[model samples]
Target chain A: MNNIEIKDLSKKYAGFLLDKISFNVPSGAIVGLIGENGAGKTTTIKSILNIINSEGTVKILGKDSKAHEKEIKKDLGVVLDDSFLSAYLTPKHINSVMKDFYQTWDENKYNDLLKQFGLPTDKLVKDFSSGMKMKLKIATAISHNPKILILDEPTSGLDPVVRSEILDIFRKYIEEDETRSILLSTHITTDLEHISDYIVFIDKGKIVLNVPTLELLEEYGVAKCTKEEFSKINEKDYVSYKKGKYQYEVLINDKNSFKKKYGITSIDKPSIDDIMLFYIKGER
Target chain B: MIKGLLKKDLYNLASYKTSLIIIVIFCGMAIIGTDAIYWGSVVIGIIVGMISLSTFSYDEMAKSNRYILTLPVTRKEIVLEKYILAIGATILGSLLGFVLTLLIGNIMNYVRPDNVIDINIDTLLATTIGGLFGVSLIQAIQIPSIFKWGAEKGRIQMFIVLFVLALIGSGVGFLIKESGLSVDIAKLESVLKNFGLFLLILLSFIIYFISYKISYKIYKNKEE
Candidate 1:
């Protein structure tokens, strides 16, 4: 069974729209939701969590998210961009508060995570730096040993060192097989590149690509050639193109066929950022 | 879970314990500032009223509802917890205010034999009834507004509520002076004594249940 299944989901805002989003994150798989700003990644996450009014079905662990929201949320952990912890509250207060709310809350796990993150139990959340606040959110998200972890821009606005530490924590969280899954949304594609097994690229509220990360990299290649040589290639073969004064870079959907048509020069791998930029700019 | 939520709110409030202590001390000063018994009672009532208003505002400013909703608890639990906290704070603050006022009244009585003042059961009952009514009004307006409109918008509604209450008070005063019912205080006291306990209990439950229902509906329909 899929860990999460979002079918025909759509939500409309005044200036933003999330249109007919459908995807599934199978148990134990890490799915990266790649999108540019205002591309509806956060809206999708909010809809899946039933945080906003939406028109469609969102199922987690084979249960309807809205009908069984409380039960579903009990085994799910969410880390939003903003810190929901009040400024006046300390980690010590959070521990006591969580103890009451979560039946599966482990005090030892919470304390260990806090110590590992170097968060002071006595310090108020208002005094925390942005990175520290992100760490705190991660600590709380993992402390319950949840079945699924949903993160929105968990690594944005953090130093490289802190970002790597958070990535490492995510790696550790998904070590268990078939029991843990993650749906991570980020504009920073580099962070998702290293850990994501699947990538779903969304542009302008519509999905452009949804496939295994390795397959995506294997099937598509960014080819660089002179403008004269670029004309020799079929326009239908490429998803997008970035032209320069002396050279033309084309994103080929079928890497193998393109290599066969022309002698393989140097086919560059497309990063998540490259895919997002090219797709949004209608370059490929 | 309710206990945890309640404790969290209390702890959050505790961070400003120093400020709260200062306010309590100010209440103590106001209780002792006036020489007349009626003036002292008015001061105590105003102080308690201010505390109730501040508590509601602080809870909204802190976004306590947003934080609580993220937990595994239900929206119903969140609404019930706020009601519990409001009522609990009112009781605790009223008791503290009563004790401080009684102490000041006794001290003044000792200093001047001719102006001796004593707090009887009637005084205590009146103070309790007035405090409960004030807290109920605050919660009735604050809970629904905050739950529906959020903290920023709710602040405006809070001011409107205060304004409406002031108008009502003045209107009642004008009616008393115009109709020559100034002597009705004795009759009012007699009626209060006869049905005061029952009325107070009924009003408290009615206010809490209504506030709870309104807040719950707002929360259920609220979109992040």
Candidate 2:
């Protein structure tokens, strides 16, 4: 059974829209949602959690998300891009508050995370730095022992050191079982590049690609060649191109065959960001 | 859930303890000056009612509703907890205010016999009932507004509610005085003796229950 499935999901805003986007994250897989600003990554996460109204069928753990929202949320963890802590509340206060709302909230796990993140339990959340606040949110989300973790841009605006620390936490979380899954939405494709089993690219309110990370990288190649030889290659086989004074960079499918046929000097592997940029620009 | 929510509210309000102390002192002064302890108690009760409304507004402004809803709790539980907390705060505040008023009254009586003021049980009961009635009505209207339109718009709705209540109170007072009926203190005492407790308690519970249902519907359909 799928861990999460979204079908024909659509939400329309005045300036931004999430078109009929659909995808599935099978049980035990880490899926990365990659897009630029205003690409509806957060919108999709909100719709799945039923935080926003949308027209679609969203199923989590084989149940409709809306009909079983409270029930489903019991086993699901969510961390939005921004902090939701009340200015006056401290980490200790939040723990007591969570005890009342969640039946499975683990106080030991929560306190352990606070120590791990170096967050002061007695200090008010408003005084915390942005990175600290994000750590607090992550602590809260994981304390309930959720089966699925849905994070939207959790690494945005944080320093490299903090981002790596958070990624380490994600890695630990997924090590529990192949049945546990994570749907992480972020602009920092490098973070996903190391850990993601599947990458889903969304742009202009629509999904461009949803495939295994390794297969996509194996099939697509970024080659550097002279302008004359670059033009000689078939345009249909290439996804995008960049020009230079002495050389040309082009993204083509079947890297091995293209390398042998054209005898290119270098065939570089495309980063997740590079793949997203080329697909978005070339599609338009 | 209700206990947790109440503790959170109380924790947040801990920093305002000095303000609460000042308000109690002011109420004591009002009672000593006016020599009408019951009316002074009524003033203190109204102040506490306003504090409850302000707390609800603060929660809205902080987007606490959205955060709480995302947790493993039902919207119905959230709405029910707010009603519980509103009533709990009102009761606790009114009890403290009453005790403070009595202490001040006794102190003044010992200092100056000529200005001594005595508060009867009936007076205390009347003030408590009136305070609860006002609190329940305020929450009944304010909760729905916050759920429907959010904090910024809810503040406007709060002012509108207060204005409407003021107008209704004035209109009722005018009719009572203009009717030329026997407006004796004995009749008022008899009315209180017969049904005031039942009426006040019933009104408070009914208003609270209705508000809970309305708030639940609004919250369930709310777009975060």
Candidate 3:
């Protein structure tokens, strides 16, 4: 079964609206939720968790999020961008509190995670730096041995070394349980680019694209050519294109086909960042 | 889940150094200050009520509710937990107030013997229950308001509710005066005094239940 499934989910506000967006994370893989600021990544995640009101349904482990939210949440671990408990609380206090919140609460795992993350057990959360706070949140999310881990910007302020370490932890977590799945949302595309098995791109509250990361890395490429060469290429061959100072960097869906048809040697594999930039900022 | 939520709130309240300081000062005043000694349990009740409200403010400051709702707890459970925390704090505060009343009353009577501020057990019981009842009523509306609109916006709602209440009070007074009804203050006081304690307790629970229902609805409908 798909571990996490969001189907036709939509949320509306005065000025913003998350259109009917759908995606799925099959068991045993990490799916990167990529989007720009205000692109409804948080909104979509909130909707799926029933944190906000929405029209469509989100199913986790084949149960509706709203109907069986409490039950569904038992197997779900969440790490939000903002810290969850009072800033006056320490990790020690949280351990005591979470001892009751989760039936799967593991004191040893929690303490070990705290030690691993280098988080001070005595200091108040308010006193911790942003990176430390994020790490603390990640530590809490994983200590419960959840079947699904949903993180919203889990590594925003984290330094590169710490970010990679956290990613490795995620890798190890999934390796530990093949049925475990991860839906991590972040703007730091490089972090996900290395580990994400599938990438879902969201723009203006809509799912612009959803494809396997392998396909994105292997099949997608940028075709850089002169204005004369750009005019010769068929409009249907490229998804979007950016007009550079001298050359036109066109984003194509089938790099192999474009290479075979046009014999373009300038084609290079596109990063998630490049795809996001081309999709959001480049013209069709 | 509710237990977990309350535990977290208790930790938050305990960590608030200023709240701890305020509690100490209030209890200290209850010991030494003559007027404070008379108020006894009421002083401690007010302090506890203020400290309990601080938990809500802390939740907002840290945006903890978003994280909390994602846990295996429902929004109704969250509202219920806040109510329980408020009641728990009130009970703790009442105990402190009651003990302080007895201790200070004895000390003052011992030190002065004559012209002393004496608080009897009956007065302490009456005032402590009365003060807690009022505090609970305010929290009934206040907690729900804070849940619906955040701590800051909820304060404005409280002001509006108070303003509406004042308007109704003035209208009632004006109508009475215009109707040539004689204002019998002592008779009215005697009527209220004669009111059954059981009835008052019943009303308090009813009000609290209604408030819980409202808070549950508001919190349940609230967006993360």
Give the top-scoring candidate (TM-score).
3
Give the TM-scores of the predictions, in the order they appear: 0.90, 0.90, 0.94
**lDDT of each residue in A1-284, candidate 1, tens digit only:** 68999999999988777889899998888999988888889888878877778999999999998888788888888888853646677888888877877888889998999999899999988889999888888888778889999998999999999999999998889895457999999988898778999999887788879989888767878888887788788778888888877788888778888988887577898877776677777464
Q: How big a share of the true inter-chain contacts is recovered in candidate 2?
A: 0.52
Ranking by TM-score: 3, 1, 2
Candidate 2 per-residue lDDT over residues B1-224, each given as its tens digit = 66767767777777577897798787787788876677666677667755665556557546666666567667777777777767777777667667777778788889998866776867876786787687678878887887787766887987797899899999998998899766789988888789988888898889888988888999876777
TM-score-wise, the better of 1 and 3 is 3
Q: In candidate 2 chain A, what residue range of length 10 has the lowest lDDT sum?
A: A275-284
DockQ of each: 0.49, 0.51, 0.84
- For candidate 3, lDDT tens digit of each residue in A131-165? 88888887888888999999999888889988998
Name the candidate that leads on lDDT: 3
Q: Rank the candidates by DockQ, best first.
A: 3, 2, 1
Sort candidate 2 into its docking category.
medium
Interface RMSD of 3: 0.9
TM-score of chain A of 1: 0.95
- Stretches of candidate 2 exceeding 4 Å from the true structure: A225-230, A243-248, B57-62, B164-193
Ranking by lDDT, best first?
Answer: 3, 2, 1
Which ten-residue region of model 2 chain B has the weakest summed lDDT?
A: B52-61
Ten contiguous residues with the weakest lDDT in model 3 chain A: A80-89
